[model samples]
Target: MTKKVLAAVKTDVETIEIREFDYPTVKPESGILRIEASGVGGSDPELYRKAGHVPVIMGHENVGTIEEVGEVAAKRWGVKSGDRVALHEYLPCWNCEWCMKGDFRLCMEVDFFNVKDRLNTDRFGMSTANKPPHLWGGYAQYMHLPLNTVMHKIPQDMPATHATLAVPFGNGVQWACLDGGAGPGKTVLVWGPGQQGLGCVLAAKAAGSYTVILAGMTRDQSRLDLSLRLGADYAINVETQDLEAEVMRITKGRGVDVVVDTTGDPKGEIVKQSIALAAKGAYLSLNGLEQQVPIGEIKKRYLTVRAPRGRSYAAVELALRYIGSGRYPIDQVCSHTFGLAQVHDAILATAGRGVQGAIHVCVEPWK
Candidate 1:
C-alpha cells in the first residue's frame, strides 16, 4: 500500500488545496477505504462559499472499496478488504438513545455544528482536517473508517459512480416517501430541479404518486426535462410561468397532496408558494439552509411541516436497493466528473457556475 495519500483540503472559503497525508494505521477498531467517487451536492457550494470551519476536507457522499480492515472492525461491520461500500457522514456515539434506536444521524455527539471543540465531534467532510489520522473526508484517495463509521454495502453489479448517489437517494426516500407520505393517487410538488429535487421526483413516482410536478428556474431547463423523463408528470418553469396559477390549474384548485422544497433559497419565496400550493392537511418536507416561513398560513392549512435532517439507516439500505434495481437512469444525474486536482472547478460546477447543464458532480481521487 502507498505510504502517502492525496486529498483536496478546503483551506478557506472558496478555496481548495491539494495536500498529502500519511496513510492511517488501522487500529483494531477501525478500517480504511480507497475512495472511488465523492459526490458534490447542493450544500457543498454553500459550505465552500460560507466561512465557518477551515482546513476541512469536504466531500460527504462517498463510495469506495474497503482497503484495510482491522480484526474487530471486520467482524463488527461484517466486511473485509475488497468490499464495496457507501459511507455515511455521521459518526455517532453508540450509547446515545438515538443511536440505540437506529437513528444515529440525530445523535447529538456527532452534531459538529452545534458542538464546540473539534475533537468532541466527528462528522466526515465537515470536521477539521487538523486532527490526527486526518483523512476525514471523501476528497481523498483513502479515508479512515473508524469503528463508529456507518456504511452500507453496495451491490456487486453497481458501479462506484452510480453508488455515489446513495446520499441523495436516501434523502429522497426519507423526505418524499417516508416523511411526506407520497403514495398511490397522491400528487406531489417538488420546488427544485436540482439533484435532491430530482431524487424526490423519482422517490415520489416510485411510491406510486399519480402526479409529480417538478418546478425550477429557467436555467434548469435541462434538469426539468430530465425530471419529466424520470417519471415526473409535469415540469414547470417557475421563472417563465405563473407557478401558483399553473399548479392550481393542474390540481383543479385543490392543490397538491405533498410539497417538497429542496431549493435552499434564502429568499423563501418557494416556501411561501408551497403554503398556497399544498392541499389541506398535506405534508411538506422541507430541506433548506434558511427560510422565513409564514407560520399562520401553515397553521391555517393544517400542513404538517417536516424538516428532513439526514438519511436513516433503513433509508440508506433502501437507497442501495433502489440503485441496484435498474429502475431509473440515475447515472444521467452524474453530469460531471472531476479529478482531485480540479476540486475547485468541480465545486463551481455543482454551484452552477463553471459548468453548464451540470447536475450531480463527482470527484474521483485517483483520476
Candidate 2:
C-alpha cells in the first residue's frame, strides 16, 4: 500500500475537512515538502468566507524542510534533503514576459486572480486538489513542489514559526522600502495594523525612516499599540482622533514622504487620505485592492504610486535575514499557533473572530 499524507482540506464555505492523499511521487524537477509552519495569511478570512473554492488546501505562506527532492530540483535549487526553506506562493512559467522582467509574481500562468485551472498550480493553495497528487498546499503534512515553485533557503537557527513570516515581511520590504522609498530622513505612514501593515512598519523603521506612523481604527488600538512597541514612532486611532491633523502636525504640515495602505479598504477612503497626506513628490503604495482611487488627485499631488502584489526574490532573502536578526519583538506579532486539525480555528483567529489580540496566526501541520 502507498503511504498517505493527511491534509486539512477546505471542502466548503468556512469548512475544513481532514482528508488523506497519496504521498506525491518526486520526479525529476519536482520535490516534496514536509510542512513545518504554515502561516495563516490575513487574506484567509475572506477566502474562507467565499464559496466555490472548496476541495483546495488553503495555506499558502509555507515554511518547511525538504522531505524529498529530485536530482534535477536539488541541483537547480541548490538544496538537498533536510534543508529548511520558505516558499513564495507563485509558480511562474519562466518563458513569460513577467517572469523575464523579474516580476514573476504577475505571471499569467500562475495568476490566481484571473486564470482558472487546477492543474496550473496558479498561486499554490488556490488550485483544486481533487485531481491526482493532491499535496499542493501548505495546510497538508506534505506539499508537492513542482519545477516552477519558488523556494528560498531559510536560516537553520530560525524557528519554523518565525520563518513563516518571511513572505509578509518580504512584502513589507518590497512595498514600503523598495517601492515607496522609505528610508533615512523620510516620514512614512502605514494604515492598517494587520500582519502586512505591521510588516511595513517594521520595514520603514528598520530602513531608518525619520518617523513611522501606523494608523488604524479605535477597535484596532491594541494592534496599533503593538505597532509602537514593534518600532513604529506613532500609532493613530483614526476613529478617536483626527488623522489629517495628526499627520500634518507630525510632518509639520509638509505631509509624509511615503504612504502605504494595507487596509484593503473597499470604499477607497484610505486611498483618498493617502493622497491627501502625501508630501509633494511622495511615494504611495496602495496595497489595498480598492479600485475607486482618485487618479486625478494622485497626479495633482505628484505622487508616485506603486501597486505591488507580492515580494521580489531579493526582498524575500533580505526579509529572512531580518527575521533572524533578533531585532524586533517578532514573537509578539506571531501570537497564535494551531495544529492541523485546528485550521478552522486558526483562520478565525487570523480573521480576529476567534482569538483576542491575534496578530500573526500559524498552523503547525504536524501538531
Candidate 3:
C-alpha cells in the first residue's frame, strides 16, 4: 500500500507527496499508539522557515489511537490495540546513560521528527525519506511511532482534542511551576502571553504562586486577558506600559521572585527589561526557541537559570491530571481547530497574533 503525507521539501515550501511505504505494523515496541490527531506547534515555524536546514518534516505534538501493540509495551502501559494515547516528541536512546538513569530528557543521543530513521529500521517503525515524501512527519494519513518515544494514555472520558495541548502545556507547567519552585508566596513574571506563556501562568497559579504577571505587546491583549482569567495577578502590556517599571511597582520595588520567558526573542529590549525587573537571586526559565539569551548579564545578576529540554510523557500526564481536576479551564485553551488541508489557514491565524488562548491547529485526518 502507499502512504500519503506532506513534506517541507525546501526552504519556504510545502507539498503533498505520495509514495509506496509500509504502515506501522507494530504499535508496541515499547508501547506506542497509531496517531489519530496530531497537533501543530510553534517549533514548526522554524522548520517551515528552514531556519536550521532544508527538507525538514516539522511537527512534534500529537495524539492518537492504538492500532497495534507489542507484548512488552502492552504489559507496561496496560493499553490494548484500540486505546487512545499521547506522543512525547523527544525520542530518547534507551541504551544511553541518561535513559538508564530514567532521565530520558538528558539522553545524549536523541531522535526528533526527521531523524527517526537513523534509530529504527523495523517496518512501520521509523523511516527516512531519500526523496520528496517523508512519512516521519505527523502530516501523513497514518503515522509510524516507534515504541521508545510514545507516552501517556488518554482516558476514555477525556476529550482527545484538549489532550493535544498536553505537550506544550506540560512545558509551561514544568518550567514555571514545578522546576521554578512556584508556590504560595512566590511572585512569577511570565513574559509573552502566548500558548506556552499562558501555560506558565496557569501552572504558576495552580502551584499557588502569590503573584502572576503576564507581560506582552498590545497586540497580545487577547492572550493577556485570558491569562488574567487563568490566574495572572496582573497583565502588563509592554508596548503601552513600562514592563520593568510596572513589575517593580507590583512587587513593591522588590522585583518578581521568578521570571519566565517564552517569547523566544531574548535579545529584544523587552526581555532585557524582564531581566532588570527580576530580583537579584530570582530564578529565570527560558522556553522560547528563537531567542539568544544574554549569558553575561545573567551571570552579573547571579540569576539561577533552569533550562528544561522538553516535556516528557510523565510531565504531560501531570498536566492532563491538572486539566482533568477542574481547577483551571484547560479545555478553553484550544481556541481553534482545523482539518489537515486547513493547516495554512490555522497557521495564518496563529501567526496573526490575536488568539485569546492556545491556538491549536487540529488535523482531522480521517475527515
Q: Across residues 312-350, which tens digit of lDDT does each residue of candidate 2 receive?
A: 998888888888999878888888999999999999988
Per-model TM-score versus the true fold:
0.96, 0.96, 0.84
Deviation (Å) of 183 in candidate 1: 0.8
Estimate candidate 1's RMSD in Å.
Answer: 1.7
Off by over 4 Å in 2: 116-121, 287-290
Please, what are the lDDT tens digits per residue for candidate 1 over residues 134-228? Answer: 99999999999999999998866688888888898888888898888899999999988888888888888988999999999899999999998
- RMSD vs true structure, all candidates: 1.7, 1.5, 4.3
Residue pairs of candidate 3 with colliding backbone atoms: 28-70, 36-64, 264-291
Give the lDDT of residue 38 in candidate 3. Answer: 61
* Clashing residue pairs for model 1: none
Q: How high a TM-score does candidate 2 get? A: 0.96
Q: What Cα-based lDDT does every candidate model obtain?
A: 0.87, 0.87, 0.66
Ten residues in a row with the worst lDDT in model 1?
112-121
